[model samples]
Target: MVAGKPFERWRVAGTRRRGLTVRLIGGIIPIVTLSARQNAGRLRQRQEWQFFATTFRARPGLAGLWWGIVVLRGVLPAGFAVAMGVLIGAIDDGAPLVAPLALTGVIFLGMQVLGPIHMALSRNMGDQTAAWLYDRLTDYCLEPAGLGHLENPGLAADQAAARDFDLGQSAPPLRLSMGFIADGIVSFVSGVACALVLFGYVWWAPPILAGCWLATHWLLRESGIWRDRNTDEVRRAQQDAEYHYRLAVDPAPAKEIRLFGLADWVLNRFVLRRRRLHELQFEATRLRERSVLLSLAVVLTGNLAVFGAIGRDLVGGGLALGAAVTFTQAAIGAVAIAFGGLNWSLDSAAAPVAAVLRLREPMATAGALPAPSGPSCPSGPTGSSGRPGSAGPLTAQTGSGAGELRLRGVTFGYPGTGTTVLRSLDLTVPAGSSVAIVGRNGAGKTTLAKLICRLYDPDEGSIEFDGVDIRRFEVEAWRAHISAVFQDYIRFEWPLRDNVAPTGAPDDMVLAALEAAGAHGLADLDTVLAKGYPGGIDLSGGQWQRVALARTLVAVRGGAGVVLLDEPTAQLDARGELEIFSRVLAETRGRTTVLISHRFSTVRMADLICVVEDGAVVEAGSHDQLMRANGRYRTMFDLQAQRFDEPQEVGGDVLA
Candidate 1:
């Protein structure tokens, strides 16, 4: 009882000392000063760590298994060293070897088993995390009701960083780098455990060894390249290099490159840009020789001092041979805390994650549309523009079909460009009538079409539909009533049926639309549109244009009451354009149609023709009336007709 009392008192005293030490550490932590840049860097790192933690929430079971393996892997090195020492001690005492051998074998087996499992888990986790980031980016990009955000050049850097994060151009892909991060974590933990094990031999030796090993991180900064290489100049170089690489690889540029004999030029440019990128990275991350030497000296001194003390104790019979062996292994394992590629992998992984998170608010704000203002505005589920939906709140409440569309005092400019594309433009299309807008390039013809389609809103005007402001209706609900084919239409590498009827329509409807667009019999409905697929064939530019027209026709058949065609027949010759435009008029006889075109043949077919000049409608009339008036339209039409009648030299330049 008396002995127990003294032991209890000793325990209490030790607890008090530990508590006091913890308090002292807490006080010191608050007093440490950090520069503004350092604080920001630490905050960013913390946010990145938080993002990484959230990835585990997606698959709890797998995450649990991964964490278990990590713990086992971390402790196995220390456990193996202790087991070896135990076996040696048993052998020297002529004790049973079976128990010690079994322990050592178990630890060794854990090391082997946990390694592959850890690798697989890291790979899967990294892939899932990358997928999550992509989905987030997609949602953020599409969440806005307007196209302003997409056109903003200021956000391009963030977009590029997020998109190229897992592409292995800047750094190792997350899948491969994830394994490195896991290994680093395990190594760090193992080192700390080894240092703790050394505590039993000598109180002061563990701190000296651990401090020296950790000091290498501050001394050399060998991973500075990965940490600081995401600067603007570096990013621009990467972009330039990637562009050159793409020129060599992409099929779209292959013909031009071969025709122009630009292979050597492209290769040289790529090499130079890559070399410049390397030079910049090296300039940012170069190590100082003096710091390296100092780090080496410090580490060597600490290791020698610890080792010399252990040897002296063992040789003088103050320590057992088994104890000496255990301490020696711990001391060596403590070197795992030294700086290595872990920082490089970690910084690279965190950069893209941080970039993606940083863009959320800016992208959202840029793409946001003003709220519907009038008391009559209807609210409903936001449907997609390309897909059909049941009659929504806007239509159900207002009971308005496609009616006379009017633009009053409209002005607009693309985001991030100081130049205004449209200034106080005004025009009107009577209900169930066709109007063709004609103008020289850069005269706001396409801009007017975009405004009518509600892809963008004017800066200072109101667009009215059926005597009510268009903004009084929900964006998606209003878009449901219109179909459009832009000049730059998407050529989806999907089957013909899917391309024509992207949201699924009746076969008869699809066929009828295809026939109307002059796209029938071009290919089988099941045939893929790209040559890369088996049993697929490529189409000419004119053929693809017809396919785009058929897609718009399908949307019309699904109850859309308005049509917008922007340079829709540019790929077709004059005769083809006339024939296609005839079919289009027949198919959309009663629908309100707006066309933007440079071809006078297609323009003359419209019921009303408006000539745009300097961002305004300078002339409006029928083709005969315009010719009689001898206005801008007349001069443009005469010039085109005269060109067609005249023949030029074989190698002479042609108007585009």
Candidate 2:
């Protein structure tokens, strides 16, 4: 019996020491500071609060309401604990139970009743903030004047990341940060209250408990990253897997994919490849979960020791009944607050926040060109109004405003690839003439056309209309007078009237343009071509080509000074292509028309034919002149003609 007494005393001493340890080291354990730099170098300098500040500034009233709710939610536990402690303490002191019971009942009921209302308010606030982030980021992306960032690979990836949040493929950054804010404040405030209660029993207990909480939060956050990781294999596997997946789903490959019967094979490949890509991330997440659970285990153990010390005093006639209830709940609250929302918000915000921050630098500097004059191209801005903006380009006629187009030392290259596509090549398109430019693919025909349209500036040259540099005039003002039909063009899903009359041309004018382009029976001006409309009618590819042709003709008939057709019939069948070219050429006789085509039949009718080779005009003349010259144009034309005339043969045997 004597030995048992000493052993019991030793056990009591050990428990006291453990309790004392928690109080002394409160928050002495370090917090894991999450730096944006860890994700991408550029994100390190970004302000994560951009979303908050923008929303707050835009809607201060809403912001105030949100802030009030979060703060109240944060300190709810602390408020409840203080009120409960008062009620219990009064009872222990032998005061009347009625007032104390009434107060406690009110406090308990308010918490339960207010929970749902508080949650709804919180959700509304999050929705407001998230919506602001979406709109602000979206405006920044689309407002750029240039198309460079839109097509760049690095910026494109950032765009994709940002769009994921817009499309809800990922968590909103504001929502994540809110969880970090609201839940983290709850945990901290409640924890501080608990530690303060522990302070009365032991001077060291509060600090020790705070320290354990900090350590638990930090350790759980970095458990997956507490050790070194190999990432190369993961990234490579992911890229390979994504490539296979894209090939299977992308519309560009749909025809070939079915022809090759690759549906099942590629689908199976995608499944296997996705597994490979996820291998490392899955393992890391699992490891982190294990580490968090393990940390929770240690924290609960320390908590049990503290609770035991307090419970012993309450039971053994050394502690007041009110103090016992407060201390017991405080210990549980401390642990509960420690595990609440800090890690989740921090982790989830990483991707979207990184995208938001990194995108600012690239997108801000893009599209910095001079603002467009207006939405619609103003009529006769160049000389029609006796001013530079009036009839110079848009209202210019062949002899009156439009003159010879001259290129001087023109040079250009695609973005990211510095290899020059156009060199120091000079050419002229005389006014009141029909000119045809023919070349092999990538011989700079398309680039030349784009330069004329001023989609991109020439690296080191000037293109002049009417002896004045095209750049001196506003870009859209100059382009407004030039009607261009490109090889690849959109067949818009709208009414035929809307498609042909984007400038809101009159019904009579629209009918005239349609008739000129040989699109008589396809659709009238009022006919809707969209599938979803009340009376929409679908048009075939050939019919659509005719519609696009009519649209171009409307621009020309509207007094466009110059007409450009770049392989306009490339998508049509051979006979349809030939027929359309013949009609358009006949329709554009007196206007300054520039046609780009490979088919010699189309080129044969041009007033002047120019052969482009290696970014220079190698030959120029009428058909008879070019045939006598026997240069690149003549050779190409003969080769095409010969193919049609010759009989098919295999190994010196003609096919029967």
Candidate 3:
């Protein structure tokens, strides 16, 4: 927990001392100083009240319901205190106790029943409100405009904070905070009522109780500051832990760790990260325990003061014995109720603050980009533009099948990187033509695919589909015609059918795709693909590649016209690669195909081959044309071909 302001610390010390001089010097000075500092802080920072107010305005009815529950909660506790005081006074007065006792019992029962019911209702309402916020926030984050804003690290950090700490726990604290506010109102009213009754006996008691209530409220405010700081630390530590966990356990690193026998090393790293998180949590727990103990001591001291005051008033005959007892009980009950409200209010505010902060990034990013502009379509022969005869076959033809893809001096770079991955290199693929991109490692083949899919925009130049600049086209509409089978394709943990038909039911298209990819005969479509289950089936690397290929084919047959294959046969043998390529060519007879590979054999089959060297196309032509020229393509082909005949060192691994 962060240290309080010097004046605030002194004020807390004054509370412990209960000296008039200390209160005047420490309490007044510190409060004034803190108030000025708070105002200055507010001026320097972005006011979050606007964000919260907007949230409240959007859900006014829900907010009102939550507030109502809080009021009920507060009323119940105050009612209990009043009933207890009345019952105690009647018993001490030596009057007939049956009527008072019955009334008190009824109030006690009502308080007990209403308190839990109110709490339950508040919890349910809070949960629904939180769910609504989560859905809205997620929708905002996933919006195209939101994606642009996520490019900023600050926005990303805010997003992470909200997800890790805010959404799940937001409701509980907010509900409690509302409840505390309601409780405070009821406690204040009850305190006033008790004061009026006591004033007829002794006027001094009301002021003392009020003074203690004010002191405790100050302590609670200070505690809230500490708790917020601690929460921030805990959130950071949890993020660190999550990062380490991903590094240790993610699928990308699994093969390397197993082959290198580094399981123990990875486990140790995870343990160290978890230990650091635990240390932070332990420190927070210790501070909280200390605060609770200190608060308990203060409460005890206040009780002792109340008892001494009551005894003195009774002996002086300034108050009757029954009245003195009633006053003391009322004073103790009022102090407890007030302090409870203060404690709950401070703790409850943390969750809402965290929730608002968490939602800030998504909200700020929302509506950053325009909606996807194009006609929507179900699986059929129609294109995104909803024009008849526009949905052409996938083949080598000028604007007859798929669509011509033209890149005019396209350039791109990854975020935070100094060097560009793709330079201003122009290339063109005629509609329905098979185009091959041959490049060494880090030569930007995958980056080109991402650009084509509109995952990113080029730093310079433009990509066009059928002469239409991709940026001007609806992003979703443009992507609907494209399908990609990347080198790092995900193997879902679902059944084989789901793996094939990711977006729909497994129909004839799925069957055709699986058969074309040479995996249909191996197992039934209903076979479970995941391992470690009763009837689970795990495929080898080559088989998984076949499944991935099948998935791409299914997408193509469904509606996609342009297919991108990034090292689709990286895990396959020479024969397997040839067979897969042959099937792809046959199945996608007229579809536009962009094949990214390092294999010379695969590149040789393309209608046009673009050999990318150092992020630029250095050589491009048909296989025979390039061979006749005997340049980079011929030399690379010769080198790779030699590996089949005789053992040779393969230089610079292509698929990293």
Candidate 4:
């Protein structure tokens, strides 16, 4: 019985110790978790602040001046408070009023003078930041050798956000929001300085008052006043709103909106999208009742405690009137650090900055071309990476000759699409010769052209230049050798001369190229293409096609050895297309030429004709040779020939 009692007593004590240990751990877990969360938040804020600083550093001179002004503005508030107290003390003592009054007046004048200068500086810095960000965006978008990233659906949201951030639909522009950021920084500095001044009266008072005011931030966090609200929902809403707004404002859609009487519909859609975006943003960043009450309670308790102590000291004659007034002013100033506009303003500015930075790596990866499988060749004058912009004028290719082109066992498909656009295709174009390709729609003719241009590499097989794989050469160097007018060519809103020679050429050369394309005398060299500009005139569809051809011709004249015409004359009629092709052939007779067309009349003029079907070449011969063979080419040609006479079994296909 005695042994059992001892054992029972020991077991009971061990159980009690275990309970104590568990209780200690339970109590400590919340503290540790809260500390970790707070630390993480602080680290995030620090990183965001660093981004702002880096953006400011983009223009060092302007940023330095801006910082100088910020510090001066922050100090002015405390200076004004002290000067007021000193002037009052002078009055009470019957001392000379001139010096104290003059001091106070000087501080007030400094305060007034600094405001406008600060605003001007902020505006300039903000503009510089915008330019810096734009430069980075351009580099990321253009640095890639291929067009893959530009077409990726996954990056569309970030791209839109980065592109249109300054439009003020999703967030305030950096130009206006930067001033708010400055004000926030000044407020925090003023608060800390004022707390220091309060230390002169009572050491304990500053910590208690500062702690209470700072605590309000934590207590009122649920108010969502200062948090970043750039959730996925917000970004999606922003993109939708931006799309609707662009549809209403852009010139391309203006005609349809008015012609179809969709003006009201577009306007209503834009309004609804904007309203939805605003609603989502607000929902993410609206104040809550409980957080507001907690914040108010904390603030009230801190102010009352600090002020009541000051009152007691004054009434008991423990402190001088001047000191008491200064302390009171300091106490009021300390509240500047409490939850305010700075948090939200920072949020707005930081969101875009963070987004732009985050996109840099992924965008670069997306845009980058797959590494070449063959041995690398020495880059042409276009540099090692083969960036197209670095290429020299046509005069730079003085010694280069037209090279033979060949494709063997080539296969390709676009990203995210399950179907292949080109199968194991093979063809050869002898140097300085012309070959024309004819195909039904979706027969991979345009895709073949793009592959040859190296705008995309083949998925399998090889496109060779003079028996060497095209991938072995730098992309820009290979591209510099070829010029193309695509079916869907760009109509640059630049001047007529620029439209002919985007990278620039001699005036005589540009004029000759324009004349060849039947685009000469359409407009003046300096006339802008878009009607919105002064002295600008819009061209008809056929005129634009000629201009696009002129662009390719100019490249050919400069030194390009290969010419690709993919339905370049589609905007013109059959007669016009025949005339254009004759002129084009006359200009590019000696150079290698690849023409993709449906017009049998024009197709017959080529040195050799090839027909593509189901992503592979099914026939190859001359116009008469293919007709003699009575193959796919003959059938398509006969169908088109019979089109003007009688209705055929086939409806309108590419043959038509």
Each candidate structure's count of clashing pairs:
0, 29, 7, 1
Model 3 global lDDT (CA atoms, 0 to 1): 0.67
What is the lDDT for 91 in model 1?
85
RMSD of every prediction: 6.7, 11.6, 11.7, 7.4
lDDT tens per residue, model 4, 175-265: 8877888888888777877888888887888888888778777776555353435567667777888888889888879998899999999
Better of 3 and 4 by TM-score: 4
* Residue pairs with backbone atoms closer than 3 Å in model 3 (clashes): 145-369, 394-590, 394-591, 395-432, 395-590, 395-591, 396-432
- Candidate 1: residue 174 lDDT (0-100): 81
lDDT of model number 2: 0.68
Q: In candidate 2, where is summed lDDT lowest over 10 consecutive residues? A: 223-232
Task: Put the candidates in lDDT order, highest first.
Answer: 1, 4, 2, 3
Across 29-106, the per-residue lDDT of candidate 2 in tens digits comes to: 322223333545445344435445545754678777766765665556655665577678887788777877777777
- Arranged by TM-score with the best first, the candidates are 1, 4, 2, 3
**Per-residue error (Å), model 4, residue 89:** 2.3
Between candidates 2 and 3, the lDDT winner: 2
The digit string of per-residue lDDT tens for model 1 on 516-585 reads 9998899999999998999989999999999999989888776666789999989999899999999999
Model 1 bad stretches (over 4 Å): 1-47, 222-225, 339-342, 378-400, 647-656
Candidate 1, residue 642: how far the Cα is off, in Å: 2.7
